[model samples]
Target chain A: MRNKFAEALYRLSRSDPRIHIVVADISPAGPMNEFRKEFPERFINVGVAEQSMIGICAGLALKGMLPFAYTIATFALYRPFEMVRDDLCYQNLPVTVVGIGGGVIYSTLGGTHYAQEDITIAGAIPNMSILAPCDPAEATAATEYLVGADRKGPCYLRFGKAGEPDITKDAIEPFRFGKLRYLRRGRDVAILSYGVTMGLAVKAAAALADKGKSVSVIGCPTVKPLDREGVIEVLRSHPRVVVAEENAPRGGLASEVKSVAWDIQARCALQTITLKDEFVHCYGSHEDLLAAHGLSVPAIVAAAGG
Target chain B: MSAAPRRLANDFDTTAARERCYRLRRRILDVSQHVSALHVAPAFSCMEIVDCIYHGLMRKDESGAYLDTFLMSKGHGCMTQYAILESHGTLPRSALDEYCTKDGLLGAHPDYGTPGIAASTGSLGHGLGMAVGMAVAERNAAKAKGRPVPTIYTVLSDGEVQEGSTWEAVMMASTLGVDNLVAVVDNNDFQSLGRTSETHPSFYPLVEKFQAFGWETVEVNGHDAGAVFRAVTARKGAGKPFMTVAKTVKGRGVKYMESVPIWHYRAPNPAEYKQALEILEKVQS
Candidate 1:
């Protein structure tokens, strides 16, 4: 997913001279090296200063330049949160904050690198658009939409690490901001997932289907400006719904679904497959951590009444 | 207020500038009269510095578009910028009258979207980094178009410099060689409820710190518009970022309130307000 983001950004920069990449002490490698080689003047490495990185992005936006601020999800959103609120969102600038390795993708790197609370923080800021693309294809499409002309105001693009296969199976819709896309159709129950967890959601839906339980798989790429009506419609139609995510339960997909469900008094049994409130202190691979935290396909399937 | 910004003469006019500063000080006091709490002292400390920038330093082109940008990073001292913006004709007089009111556009902090405000700042340690960003963008854009890079100016408070982010910005600015960027620290020696020197003695010798950080650094009397102007303008094309530590009185122009920490966020009582006005009137005489 990170590689797809870099490639998509590289492709976009070919036509848009206004696109500038601002990173904080992250070394240039792979596609980034090519981007640096092609646009030496445009790539700014602020040298491990996250706060300054955010401020500079706002400054660039003020000068009519579109800046993509990239870093680990934790640093991108947590380190300079005030700058995100004051400099970018407050000004409603067109600065795209690209937070790589969203969720516990950096599983072995410990809690400091984990981005369990990015959605809660980023979603609360006004004028902030969030996109958590599930796979390489969606990641590419999301990057293009965020940095494209008619630029959206102050967006947070949350992506996972590389090598996730396409979950959409070439049945992708033209990427729409703030709208939910469905990958499977059923009636008895539905599983709505976003970001890297969409694969697990697809697996869970298939597992539930095999057990003779009709289940729908929903892909939520646009996290903020959540599909409120879509959420309500799904709640009203299904007897049970499961909102799955890699983030904390407090303000992730489940929180949005719960809030929307409450607004119209929808009476569906809503369940969540999310990270525990505590940190994943154990060291392991990303998949191991996900399984340990009850986000494995079988766990999700069990939660979906398989 | 004039409908268009009144550009000051090219030559430095100390006496005229002094007179303008006094009038602006008086105007700022008048605007803050009805408000219950404000950083009048902080604003007064940077009044001359901000006055010099908007009136004497910030540039405009033949099309009347401003060539340079200024961010009030020391957001609490925003009254100074607001008053100057009014005089610069960027804002109407009515806006000043409605300051901090329910229907007013103005707040304790400077918010972006107000005419002439490039960034919303009041949260300390935010403005300078944004200024550095603006400078980088200006330089990049200029290099792209083969034009001269426009300067970016931001004012910081003495106490605000204590924030780690401020140093983060300081380190990044010089490292990037943001020569088009200029910063003026309103060194009034006071924090919210204490003197910065007493609260944090190590913060002293700021000039040497900035110098060591790879910047062209200087210290000046912040209240002297001419000195502030000379020190700041001297850094143009200096090939490095510049930092001016302008020593100032916290509650300048109000004799009894000057250097008084309690005056940091207070509206003067009737007697104090009268005495403050009398002090400025005496300076006018």
Candidate 2:
């Protein structure tokens, strides 16, 4: 799925002469091979330096060019948080930050590799718009919006690893940034998920339906702007809301929904199926980690029952 | 009001530039008194480097538009840049007088939207990478127009080199062979708390480190306006980016603050300002 998103980015770069891809040394892997092979002049490899990558992208934006900087989730944003805030966000430069492997996707690499709280840092910054697409199609749509000339400021696009099937259907309005995709409409229970957790949320909704529990799942790709109206509308109608994500609950979608729910005077039970506040010392496959951290489909079903 | 942009002739006016720098220091002192604090020692150390770049190195085209780009990568020393640009008549005097004040267009660091500032800096290690990006952009723009690549100048401080991003930019600049880029290091050897030499003894031999990374390196007396100007100008079309390590004192003109690290941030009071002005006045530029 990430490969499709990267391919879309490469294809977009081909059409727009103003578009450029700058990396902190992720070439010869993923879709970078194609980008570097065809557009060597436009593809810059900064050699594992995330801070320089952001600053360089800012510089390119200042020169009337658009730059997409790519790197792993943890190394990409956390290492250069200050640069992202000061250089890209402060200047409000049109640099698209393509962060791959969000929310424990880097399983088996230990805690250092996990990028759980990327949204928290990115969402907190001023003049920054954030998106975490559920699958490749949504990722491509988000990428197109970011590279578009209409984007007013810096954007962070977080992607879960490849091979997650599309949790969204075509009948839903085509992917638009800052708009939520309503996967199902139901009363009594509203389950909101961002990024890869959408698949689990959908599966959980189906299980709860079999048990005669009415459930609706909403996939929120753009977490920062958050489609405030859409969220408020959902809260107004629903009696129970459960926020699900494969990230820390403190600053992830759960916290954001609660912040919105508190002032709206909505009467709903709030439950979050996310990682605990502590670091995960255990190492395993992606599924094993998710299950151990209580982010599996069963966990979603249980949380939805609330 | 912002001054009208003008393409002043760059014939290497040494005497006039030297005199301007001297007076610029005094002017910075005057402005520093009004503000709660300014980076006086940092500004003093890199005063001539900023002057040399703005006066001797920058190339402005006929339309009074600047063709070249410069970034104060060591942004804490922006007072030096503001002082020099103000002296060159490109910046309004009111901007300098109200610097770092509530209504000042100027602040402790260089901001992009302000008049004549190329990039917002003062965040350590951002300027060099930005300059590299600017150089690459200039190359692409030149290729589009079938013209020469415009030079991009960035002034870095010795302490700023400690940031890993600085070395990352150096690696990329050499790999790309960005000959249009030139970096001037205001090597006064002081960090925020103390001398970099005493705090981190292993960080020396900057010339060799930059050369090892494939930069055309040079060393000079940073205080000498003529020497700083010559070292930068000599690197034109050198087939690689150039770096000048200007060995200097932390406080170049003042009596008590020379080589002192506390003055890196601490501004002079009225009495100290008077004594420093007397010492600065006696220097023969």
Candidate 3:
């Protein structure tokens, strides 16, 4: 997924001079060396200055350039929220904020680097479109969509570290902003998720199916300006809906799904599999955080009563 | 001191201009009091600075052409800006009365839709970047169309220097050789939480810091309108942005209010309001 995202970025930069990237002295760590080498004039590395980098990107966007600000999710979203609000969202500039190491992807770095709260913060901002793709193919699709589309405001794209399994097929429909794709269909329950967590969701659904329970998995790549109609369709068809994400339960995907359910008067049982209120104290890899948070396939299957 | 006073036309008078500054200060106090807004201290601090720009630096006819470009990045001091615009007849006095009210264009911060307001700002650390971008754009557009470049001015609060974005804009402005840009920092020594020295200390060694960043720097007493006017009207640097560190006093005209931290947030009550009005009336008298 990381390679695909980089390739898409490189391809987009080839045609659009307006597409620029601001690195926060962590381009090599964020896997953006190729982009730096390719577009030197368009690439800016304001060393270790996360807040200023975001501001500079906002300024570039205001000057009629489309800037993609790259950094780890923790520093990208939390460190410069005021800049995002004032410089980008307030003016509705087309600054694409690309956050790598989302969720537990930075597990080795512990809680400081973990990006479990990105969705909550990004979701709260108005005029900001959030995209968390399921795989490399999906990431490429999202990149193309954001670069080419005439968006109303700024956007945020969250992706994990490299070498994730591909969940999307080449023949699938082209990605659209705020649209959902039903990866699998069943009758008993609907499994909804996005980002790298979609892999767990798919595995959980397959496991549930093996136990004689029909489970459907929906991949919602876009989190904000949510596909309300798509969510309504899934709720109407299934007796229960389970929202699984790597973010906190509060104000994340589950919260959005709940809002939709309430508005449409859907009586389906809505369950959310997410991180608890307290921070993770144990130290391990990304996989450890996932297992500890009960986001693993086996845990999700058990939660679904399979 | 013996230099001839630079005049706009036959009607320009130093005594009249001084009187206008006092009137402008009064309007700022009234509008701010009515709106119950903060930043009154900083707003008062920048009155003469604004007056100097409107009367001395800006060319009346060319000012209208550059309306789409001016940005008050230090948006907290919007009352001063409103008063200056109203005095210039660019904005109506009624709008000042409706400031910070619901459905009012004059927000506590300057908004884009308000007459003569270039960009919406209240959020710190954004105005300078926007100004830099605008200046760069003007330069690019001029090159493309073979037209003269438009001037861009951004006002910065001393507290805003703590924000890294200010430096980012500074770097870019220098890198791009943005000669048409001018940034004025209102150095009133106070921020939102406390004094600049107490909160986030900035040792701005003004000229050295800006000169190192490729800017032609100037220092002036912000209250002295003559010095401000002279500094702004000076010749532009060769392919480098200009910066002015204007030393100012928070709550300049109001005697009891000057240099008081409470004035940063506290709105004037009826008694204080009356007293402020009286002081303004005496200045006018």
lDDT of 1: 0.84
- Model 1 per-residue lDDT tens digits across residues B127-182: 88888888878887888788867888889998779888888889888877888888
lDDT (Cα, 0-100) at A97 in candidate 1 = 91
How do these models rank on DockQ, best leading?
Answer: 1, 2, 3
Ranking by TM-score: 1, 2, 3
Instruction: Give candidate 2's chain B TM-score.
Output: 0.92
TM-score of chain A of each: 0.96, 0.95, 0.95
Tens-digit per-residue lDDT, B80-188, candidate 2: 9888778667789999888877887888899988878889988898998888888888777777678767888899999889999899889888887888888999999
Fnat per candidate, as a fraction, reads: 0.79, 0.63, 0.25
Best by TM-score: 1
- For model 1, what is the alpha-carbon lDDT of residue B226? 81
Question: Model 1 chain B, poorest ten-residue lDDT window?
Answer: B1-10
Candidate 1 stretches with Cα past 4 Å from truth are: B1-10, B281-285
- CA displacement after TM-score superposition, residue B190 of candidate 3 (Å): 4.6
Pairs in clash, predicted candidate 1: A1-A162
- Pairs in steric clash, model 3: none
